[model samples]
Target: MALEDVPRLGCGRSIDEVWAGIDQPPTGHEEHCQYCQTARTRLQRLQEATVALRESDLHDPELKPRPGLTRAIMDVARAEVRRGNRLLVRTTDHGTIEISEQALDSLIRIAATAIPGIHSRRCRIDIRTLPNSPHETTSTARAPRLVINFRVAAAAGIDIPKTVDALRQKIRTAIPAGIGIDAGTINITVEDLYDV
Candidate 1:
């Protein structure tokens, strides 16, 4: 069948079949023949770039998030997403990306950190504080509610629960607003009730 007559892969043929069909020597039909060559070259380049990107190292700080790196990674991710793959967009610059689960986590943490009253270094999100903890007694009107644990070296006599509540509010506000992600849930557990 003429290249034009052949069913397009996307428009459904297996990759092997497509490759085999294209590899067959072009017939004398100039129009379809040229189209086949162009399609082959384009697909080859895309495959080459995909392999190159897969082997790329994005772990080193110097290379981890270089400008435009995220966009490059996102380009591939978007392609996959369009192909029915569910993937997260970690970073993007003009459209490319470098998908890294660690990077996404860091982004989320940074978003949480940006909240006012949240000490970036000292505070953490999703920590589990037991119901009977020291701070639970302040509001004993009902079942002890969980807290978003923010470990801080706070001064003695400071109300840990109160401080955590304020931090939680800041995190909730900053996360969606600053990073555009839903602030899922915050359960602050104060591990280091420091003397600060």
Candidate 2:
């Protein structure tokens, strides 16, 4: 890999590859390359920190993370991948929240505006598309999963988690049950807490 590729690796590179260069030291052109040197230094520091943390006897729940932590981490990481260059997502809210990554912003704009709720203003929702693998042969399978992110009125004395959970259930029930098409994954992100 080119020297420039080293720093661009971010956290994606394998630890072995990183350590190999750091331990053995790259010769010739690589020795003079600043990018590789910086990457090596960063990797070494990260390794040291990881080792030190592992050896520490601290038992903080935050550091250890609760169960399903990996799943949560993946969710956040996947959102970044889905967001890409798109900044706003809109869908036509027609008493039902039908959201998907494809034409997401436009669809959210339509859906949210149709719903009646003054406090529901300024709701931003992002839908991520999840494609079905080729190995799975389902004739009725439609598009990929859609992850929805939105903000709604929270101060309506409503149970936020229950409401969100109900909304998700409604989406799952209505989409395939009514339309007979698998509606991709729906992820809802509540951006702002509103007082209703």
Question: Which candidate comes out best when scored by lDDT?
Answer: 2
Summarize candidate 1's per-residue lDDT along 1-196 as a digit string, tens digits.
6666755644244344545555355445423555555666676777778778776754435565578888999999887754431223232334423334333345445665544334444433332223354443332222212123344344456666676677667667765565454555665655544343
Task: Quote the positional error of residue 77 for candidate 1 in Å.
Answer: 27
Candidate 2 per-residue C-alpha lDDT over 1-196 given as tens digits, one digit per residue, 9 for 90 to 100 = 7755553444455445657776565756446666566777888898789878876737656667689989999999988766544422222223323434334444444544444331333433333434556664443342434444455554455666776666556555555654444445556555456555
Worst 10 residues of 2 by lDDT: 87-96
For residue 35, give model 2's deviation from the true position in Å. 72
Top TM-score prediction, candidate number: 1
Least accurate 10 contiguous residues by lDDT in model 1: 139-148
Q: Report the C-alpha displacement of residue 155, candidate 1, in angstroms.
A: 3.4
Q: Give the TM-score of candidate 1.
A: 0.30
Off by over 4 Å in 2: 1-143
